[model samples]
Target chain A: MNLKTLRDYGRVIFYAAEMALRSNLTDSFVLFGILVQPIIIALLAFWMLGDRGGEYIIFVVIGSGMTGLWTSCLFISGNSITQERWTGTLELMVSTPTPVSVIVIGKILSNVLQSLASMVLSYTLAIVIFGYVPTINQPVLFTISLLLTILSYACFGLLISPVFVLNPDVQRLQNGLEFPVYVLCGFMFPIALLPGWTTPLSYILSPYWAARALHATSSQWNGLGEVALSWAAMVALSLIYLMLSSLLFKRLLRRARLDATLNIQ
Target chain B: MKAIEVRNLRRVFRATIGVVRRKIKEIVAVDDISFEVYDGELFGLLGPNGAGKTTTVKMLTTMLIPTSGEARVLGLDVVRSAEALRSRIGFVFGGERGLYWRLSGYDNLRYFASLYHVDPAVSRKRIPYLLDLVGLSDRGQEKVEGYSRGMKQRLHIARTLLHDPQVLFLDEPTIGLDPVGARELRQVVRNLQAEKKTILLTTHYMFEADALCQRIAVIDKGRIIALDTPEGLKTYVKDLAVIEFEVYGVPSNVLEQLRAQPYVHTVSVENRDQKQALLIHSPRGSQAVPDLLSMMNGIRIGNVIVREPTLEDAYVRLVGGEA
Candidate 1:
């Protein structure tokens, strides 16, 4: 790309982020979902674990926080295009000189920022209320794991974004996928606890490795090599999802143009 | 060079009906049609609802792909060079939904400016100027959700003008606005034309087309049935005179009686503020006015006038029966 095209893309990303932030700030329901849901899940985890909760407090905190992240990705990032469609802005966006992929990426970036903020809020609330602060043996690895987890989830959200455009019964699919993903990705528990057949599914899910890497880095139980492997797997899976989502984005635009569905629906 | 060139453009939509036993239906939203719009001309596409006006505009704006033929804007193919063409053309569909309601009107314009890659320095100056031009300078800081329908429509125009595009396609820009709001928007469109910009406008309002467009195309059923200058089109009804009269409470029988007159070609009734305004078409010119008054049977006639055929009369004559 030339300097001008690159500059235009940068502007697209910048403006998209600004709009998303403005929208999220003004939406009380969304703010409540992002802030309150994680705290409720953290409290539930605290009560359920009881006597053994001390050691697993960090695990539950991170899991519940990741749940908020997952919700943001699903509702905010994945459904953004559908929201645009409903608002009648999707066609206008598509007609712009900037590629749709760049616009979607900008949305993902903004949602990721919001998701990270939610994670931080969840962690702080857990620490303040429950008084359980685990020792992080490798702070650098934990930070790396956190960033990768957010990036991978953003890619996952992008992958599913096109499905909403193609299918009309997307709410059913969206509702059905949420809990299954939480279970399959081992958000609140270990994949070893799940059935044997589900292990392969967990292995391929980016969030499972993300959760694993986070837990290992926090507990310092696994060596640097194992943590690096988990990070590598997450990055590789994220790359694959991003590539697939790009193809899906192109197909979605082509289908929308051919069917004249962008403006109508 | 022609600002826009459409050659045999067409668009077909596949619609599925029923649940268990589904059937596929093919709809020709835009049939094979072609037209050219010259630079610095205010062109109008006059059509009724579901008349393929929006479909044609979508094809030229690169929002929808044509099924069989081609369209070029600013010498670039809409399909092959959409990215470059987009920078040179802008469009606004009538309605208030296309904007981000949560953002302020100024922010909305700024966001669109960024999308079009307008320089920040230029946009800073252009945005306020446009906001002022659209009469929204005072409301620019207000969130769009708080604005009225007219304000939103005005903001839409400002948003489209952010990137100083050479050509603009506006599809029914004033569909649901009040008369005052519609008049304001028409004035803005006229000003845009005065700036030497090429514009393609589509509306069902004949007077609007007559007042603004240098050339108008009357489209119906996905096809252009007539294309000419306003005066040229009006000449089609040169021999016909329209007798328009208002009645406070005219019954349907009186309308039927008027229609039964051999000299009266057609009678159309329009309800205005609880009163009925009847438009009678006849080749007898003002000579038929005396007969129309007598047929009223001493009914409360408020205003009666005999005038030459308007662009609306010409439109009704051409597409009245078929549409």
Candidate 2:
């Protein structure tokens, strides 16, 4: 792309991010989802862990953070297009010169930012209120793992958004996927403990690799090489999802225009 | 060069109904319709609900691909070159559905301006200018949710103008606005016309179409049955006069009886404050007034008058009823 085109895309992303932030800031309900839900989940997990919680406080914190991220991905990013469809802005955005994918990326980025904030809040709450702070053996690796995981989740959200737009009833799938994903990905525990048949499924889930890397880095159970491998796996999977989602988005848009279903319920 | 050209454009929608026993139904929204909008001309598409006027606009604006044939705006094909075409055209649909209600009016415009790729410096100046043009200068910073229907409509107009498009499409821009708000919006449209912009407007309001459009196309049932200048369209009813009268609680049978008359072309009824205002058209001119009054048959009738043909009369004659 030329400089002008790049500049235009940058502007589109900037404005979409601004809109996402402004709208979410005003919505008390969305704030509750981002801030309160993870804290509540962390508190309950800590109570359940009890004396065993000291050894796994970091796991609980990261697990709750990932849960918050998943929630934002499932509801915020997934429903972004649905919200726009209801507001009647979806058609307008499609008719514009900018590609809708770019606009959606901007929205995903904004939601990812909120998810990160939620993760941080969950960690702070565990440390300050629950009096549990796990030692970080590889802070740098953990940070990299966290960022890549967030990016991957954002892409995953983008992948699901177009599906929601084409079939609004699929939104119920968001609620259905939440707890199952936590269990399957081993967000609060080790995937090795799960059944052998579920190992393949965990390998395919980016969050499983993310949680593995985070847990290893915090407990020093794995070396730098192992953590690097986890990071590589998450990045590769994220790229695949990003590319696949882009293709899906284009196909969905073509179908919508041909079917004339963009404006209808 | 023509600003817009359409050839045999059509759109068919397939909708599924029923849960247990689903059935698919086909709705042909825009039939084989063709028309040209000249550069710098203000063209109006006049039609009633379900008449396919909005469907036609959607096709032209690249929101819906045509089922067959082709549409071009500013010499660029709408489907193939939609990305480039979109940059040069703007559209505003009637109602307050498109704006981000939580954001300030200015922020809404600013955001759309970016989507259209308007230069930052240009947007900085153009946004304020558009807000003022739509008479929302002082309320630019207020959240859109707090704005009234008319104010939201005006903001919609402002949003469309952010990119300085060559062509503008407005679909029923004054659908539910109060009289004063609708009039203000019409003035904004007039100002855009003064700037030599090619605009394709769709509205059910015949008077608004007559006052604004240089040429009007009356569409019904997915077809353009009549296309002409407002004055030329009015000529269709030149030989007939309209007898308008008010009555208390007129029945449908009475309207059916009036339609059965040989000289009577059409009868339209409007309800106002518990009274029905009837506009009866006939080739007999004022001579049909007495017959119309007599047909009332002891009904409480009040204030009858005869007037010359108007664009509305021509519309009723062409479209066959109220829009």
Candidate 3:
């Protein structure tokens, strides 16, 4: 509400993010999601779509990179609160003056930023292994889209962490929720190929708009109008997610306190 | 001057059972407990396992909303003003689980300091001081995972003091510490109390409570059975004397016979190596010792002695006779 409070929140976020990054460096599962899995997916995409020609190489790179980002968000960021619970720090985090959501935002920021290494790795794979140079058709627009993607993805992650913590049954669906997003977001192929009924589901997901924006900028220029629409969708969805996540966090705390389940690992 | 006030605070947990036909069972963890902790006083909640000590602390710390009634710390209602109160009070739930194992002790302190909104300038100076105070300055840079359990417990104490809160809650702070470590931690608690910090400590260790707390509340089965100073509690058993018998192979039937005696207040047994130490509490005092020894006719009796009742004896009786 005040500047000092905001500054305190900002510091908490940065501190939380820094600690998460430090802690995540040794996690083999996180390393696989951010580093190894994306490269494997990119290699497979290159071999599978080789017949599609050189122009599609950049598309595969972006698609595979986006898959890495979604994977990290789904597994790492989604489990942020649950991880705290496991460590027995959820009670401490909740007891702090700073809001738990701010701390989680910081953790999501680190995971997303760390996952960006997937894009760099994919680009390197194309350059070194395949002897191909992939360039962004619209570098400035691509950069803007990248920033919005991070914001939207962070917000999306915000919604997920609380849900997973509150409903472990939904968390059991985590592995199942991964590849569907890749297909629905058209990470390796166009969603246009999917059944019409699922289009709305894809449209509702911020990652789909992110993939469309990135793919359009990297391989094909779908037009400024289309890119702007994707940006609008991402921005709007991010705001909605932020608002919804606030409600979810409130409910989460209330339910946890009432049920006395915050410390029940 | 009251730092903490609790009025008829109660918490009921609904535990669901069965896979197909679910049944919700209500468990009253804390039932209508009322007390006040004055500022600068060291208060102890003494109880055995499942005595709702942790539940009471959780409610006061605003981690769990009371199922009914009220708890206020630092003049703020725990439920209504939780956010405002969090920074003003500190707590440690006894364990090795709370710290970030991957992070160094210093970094863990830094992280929690920021969470408490401690000024960067203050934290920079205070972090090293706290590390030194907890005797971890030499190892502060090492990952917490490498620290011993006692070291981790000490670090938890330092972590809670990051904001210099006025009110503190410690739930079983020395649960598993060795004697020396537990003694050192108790000294630290004493020093905090000396600095005029109001503290509420919960522990099953009666000696720790006796050594540290100015006043103690003995809770059992979701109720406060006794609230008094160590001396005051000891008085509850003053009418009785404790007689001890060191014997090998004391039969259960003989133990039951001692318990069944009209003059016997309570009988408890402690198993030592190859022997059982029997403590019999009664108003009959040493006069009953001969009869008690006569009852265990077949046992190999070693040493027999009579002593005055202590806070632990009072506690055992108040909690319904299990030490």
Give me the TM-scores of chain B across the candidates: 0.90, 0.97, 0.97
Give the CAPRI class of candidate 3.
high
Clashing pairs in 1: none
DockQ of candidate 3 is 0.93
lDDT of model 2 at position B178: 97
Which one wins by lDDT: 2 or 3? 3
Tens digits of per-residue lDDT for model 1, B68-127: 998999899999998788888989899989999989999999988888889999999999
lDDT tens digits, residue span B1-323, model 3: 99999999999999999999999999999999999999999999999999999999999998999999998899999999999999999999888998999999999999999999999999999999999988899999999999988899999999999999999999999989998888889988998999999999999988889999999999999999999999999999999999888988777888788889999988888788989888889998989988887888878989988999989899988976776
Q: Write model 2 residue lDDT over B1-323, tens digit each, in one string.
A: 89999999988988899999999999998889999999999999998899999889998999888999899999999999988899899999998888899999999999999999899999999999999999999999999999999999999999999989999999999999999999999999999999999999999999999999999999999999999999999999999998889888888888899999999988888778889888888888778887777888978988988899899889988888664
Chain A TM-score relative to the true structure, per candidate: 0.93, 0.92, 0.98
Worst 10 residues of 3 chain A by lDDT: A46-55
How many pairs in model 3 have backbone atoms within 3 A of each other, for residues 3 or more apart or on separate chains, i.e. clashes? Answer: 0
Give the true-contact fraction for every prediction, in order. Answer: 0.84, 0.91, 0.97
Q: Candidate 3 — which residues are off by over 4 angstroms?
A: none
Residue A41 miss distance in model 1 (angstroms):
0.8
DockQ of 2: 0.87
RMSD of 2: 1.6
